[model samples]
Target chain A: MDVSFLFGQFLGGLTTAMFLFLIASGLSLVFGVMRVLNFAHGSFYMIGAYLAWQAMQWLEPTLHRFWLAALVAALGVALLGAVIERVLLRHLYGREELYQLLFTYALVLILGDAAKAIWGTQQLSVSRPPLLAGGLDILGTTLPTYNLFIMLIGPAIAVAAWLLLTRSNAGRLVRAAALDREMLGALGANVGAIYTGMFVVSSFLAGLAGALVTPIQSIVPGMDVEIIVEAFIVVVIGGLGSFWGTFWGSVIYGQVLSFGILVFPSFSIFSVFALMAVILIVRPWGLFGRPIR
Target chain B: MSRCRILAAACLAACLAPFAAGAESTIKIGFPMPLSGPAAVYGAPVTKGAEMAVQEINAHGGVLGHKLELLERDSKASADEAVRLARELIIKDNVDFLVGTLTSAEAPAVSTIAKENRIVFIAPTSKSVQLTSPKNLHPYLFRLASNTDIEGHSAASIIAGWKEVKRVAIIAPDYAYGRDAVAAFIGYLKKARPDIQIVDQQWPKLGQSDFTPFITAQMGTHPDAIFCDVYGGDFVTFAKQAGPLGYFKAVNNRLVDGGEVGTTDEAQALGADYPYGIWSDAYDPVIWAGDEPPEHKAFIEHLKAFTHEKYGSGWAIMGYSAIVALTDAIKKANSTDSDKVSKSLLGLTFDTPVGKRTFNAKTHETEMGEFWGQMVKGEHYPFAIISNPKYLAVGPFTD
Candidate 1:
């Protein structure tokens, strides 16, 4: 492929990678702190996308109102995550992870039917709030402003979380729990409250991830199934429970999708799997995975 | 009155009403369609249309003194569900005629059930060629909808006409529809345009939301065009993502089909800028969108009348057309008997918004050709309009 065309594919991969990061990061944070896979992370992402679209439609004033709406929509989804955790997920805390998976999967079915009942099985879209709809001309291709915004947001969230985790006191507790739950419990950290708080935070992150991608991809019923598959692939490739590892995994996946096809068209779809195989074979714990202490 | 006497009278009335309804009865038509699942988009329109046919038939003083009562159950597009529902419709609902099933998978299952029950089975949605092909086990089956053979020829011919088209990529939902559409499109295109290379062919499952990796892979090969047989939300999501990713713009042309253009609900999911140069078959509202080319005026009027009298437009009309066939067979037979109706339906022809739809006696496939359209700015329709339509019959379909 030529330079410009290759770059276009790279950009495409990067944009996709950003969403993967959002999903994987949330999934990782939950596992890192609470040791749950949050199989319904995809559902949260789906719900957030729908809710974000709904919120914007409800608040439709003008073109410029969208950026603010997008932010608020993310916040709104974060609140939804909090609610979901408090009401439903909290009950699963004392149970085994298998039960949690089943519960969340059940929630996926319920939420999907609920979404269909409320929204109908119609394909829904939210216009780019007018202001961000236009594209930037790059090497004769029009790159959507919304996509660029999404890619930018991935690193921004990653950095922000890193800072919060390292610099803040809550981050200390999170690290403490990540190190050893038994020790933290003995230290009188009110482990149950911390775990609940962790679940809410993880759900919020997943919701935010969904809200971020709405402008890039359309929201429809069953969006969760697709999004979750990609998220699972990323999380596995990056090594489970490693926050920053998700960052690298997304980029690697994006690049694989971009360059794999260029090199070999027929086998390209299997490219991500090939890389994952190599990663697992070479470093089964993932490039950055830490043993559970 | 004593309780026993009152109960006896009420039971007698209840028993006699169905018997009375049955004695003066029209054929009890039964249907099980995916009224709630992914296939519901097609099933809903089809059911509504068939019901309208039953209504019109019953309005004309019942067929041979029997008023038609339509019975329906939602199959949700699963073969298992369709079979279960079909059994219930046949055994309990006591339907004399059976219809429905949007998925080809469910089509034969229901048909087999109908065959065992000896009910005339007419599928309004299932377009799998094997349905009535003598090879199919159920000889009692018939469908008035065009099959994939005609679609393949039409699609191949459509691609041949495009100037910038060279290498064509195929992506379809990996099922009967997908497999058939790819086979037909490729077969015809190879025959029509030997120079045009058939590039990558990919099939994703139905209800799949992510097409990025698939689309990205196709884009990498840098094919001249992409043709998709994906429908419903699958089409909508693909279009929305593909449109923004410049997947359409990068190619010389793109073709999206599988019954999406007829409805606005899913079309709205693709947003305003639907592909302009792409070719897709649908009963386009464009005739109402008004460039008023030739007989389109009368056609538009007929379409509006039919739609208003049936469904607003699109699948509603398609469904209505299918029902028209079923009801017409019953009318001609002048009986509610399945054997009689089935015999009459053989070698049947009728006028519809989709043009003259006739079924072949041997194949039981509709002979009406498919229409292909180009996108244009139409006043009435929100999305692009389909202008140049093709009428290719079941001639090219062998399987």
Candidate 2:
């Protein structure tokens, strides 16, 4: 009830919001440009965590090993995304929306099984680097240094992504493609290549989020499904395909969950869905999303 | 004409070979468990334990001259899937007995199937009381693991001994298992220590990756101790996230966890991040410094060889005990008939690696207790081991 306690809760919510933003942003981008709802995005995130853990095992124990492992995981997932897009997804883009949705759903099952086969169903964990292993006491509440790092990185990624999508030539082409693929294609732009590129970038973000979350969460089977549901909710609440909408949506969700626990401890699970339903009824296209043509 | 008659005889022998082989003396037990996914952390080890038990039993001239064979199938930790597998194992595979299922949700459903088929089913590790409650209890269904009430009471008794502790908070996965355990703990704790204040309770859904808000919210309550029931990977995550935030230190490191987080697997998984000094329980412990029983020592040796792991898991003992109990029942009844075996299983006294366990005839539940102790660093292993471990018998509480 006190100001300090409220402030602490807010900070905690912010940390969760940042984590959600990382995963949802990629989902939003993929939907925005390619109109393909990638259900395997969470699988990519899970693989990222697993890869990071494996990489950490192979790498020498050092202060910078955590960051290096995370980079490797993100890149690995991005490469995987590229191959999936090229080999399987490219064929389905021309088909009905149902086919695309089913394809991604199939990927979810396959990737989930694949992860289990590779990881052998044991729960794995990655330790935080020594530099980020401590805590920072703020307003009489101790917050994890790793959580603080995530908070900072989330916004930084948002800014970087915004600059890329709005300021750069590649960004302009991607935006144009999202608006009108046929028009962009008529303008002699490589539409297929742009779609692939967007998918890779989205996958990279998801992978990065997964690798970063390893220090806090135990990497286990079914984590892919757990995270995908939340990420999907975030995207849906923010209006699918709206990058900034995802950012704000995550913020709203994180706070609702954090404070909702305080107010209604037993009903916190329903709070997220209730908020989503309200948002849909009030603003069907999402807060920042435009109406579909 | 003579050559054709000889060929016809040979063909008839080949066609009848399968039925003749099917009648060969072997007792088939259906083992349905989560072999893949997150639940496999417990399921895989449990299956290994059952396999070890089956091997040991078969080596000793079999159970009443019938070699025991396990028909293992992946239940995938879903109740529907477990029910489906149970039917298939009963109808198609024609298994004589059933012994598997790792979760509360799956066990009760499978119990119904066992009831309908009139096959003896021994639940290895599902701790929900609903599995063997009065309304649901049947002649064929039996539970090996201690129910939620026993587990909760065990935690309560442990906390009651801490004279300085007053304000207590609870955090558990928001479901029947968690709710039941917490309710039992509070009900017992209030009777034992009336002065103790129940400060706050947080019900995080199972598989929730984030524990920050819950952690911070509980910390705000300023409780002297926390009773946590989060288990497996979720517990690992909770500890990792809570450690850096000084949540353990703030409560003076007095958290009593009742989900078998004291097991070697959990300790090793969490490693240094494992919250030391937290009171927890495990069904079996591989390391028993001065009080190691010969049977336990031998079992650990076999388990190490079987699983190719340095330390035997506490979870494995549940599966090992179930098989041992089934084989013992079969020996007592001197028959593979479900009715006979189920009758024999009642008031059945069996030897486990930990010690002797008995199934109460009235409840159809095993009097299985766990080794409760505070976790602390030991010189022998990298992870924390139970310090001053005490095996709390469920008899006193259950009766």
Top DockQ prediction, candidate number = 2
- lDDT tens digits by residue: candidate 1, A103-210: 878877887777778776556766554655667878755567777877898999899989989999988898898778889999888777777777777777777777
Q: Is the docking of candidate 2 incorrect, acceptable, medium or high quality?
A: medium
What's the lDDT for all of these models?
0.71, 0.90
Tens-digit lDDT track for model 2 on B140-257? 9999998888888889988888999999999999988998889889988888889999999999889987888888888888899989999999999999988998889988889999
| Model 1 TM-score (B-chain only) | 0.86
lDDT of 1 by residue, B134-218 (tens): 7674556887666776666666776677777788887777777778767877777777777899778766567654466567567
Name the lDDT value of residue B99 in candidate 1: 72
Docking class of 1: acceptable
Q: What's the TM-score of chain B for every model shown?
A: 0.86, 0.94
Best by lDDT: 2
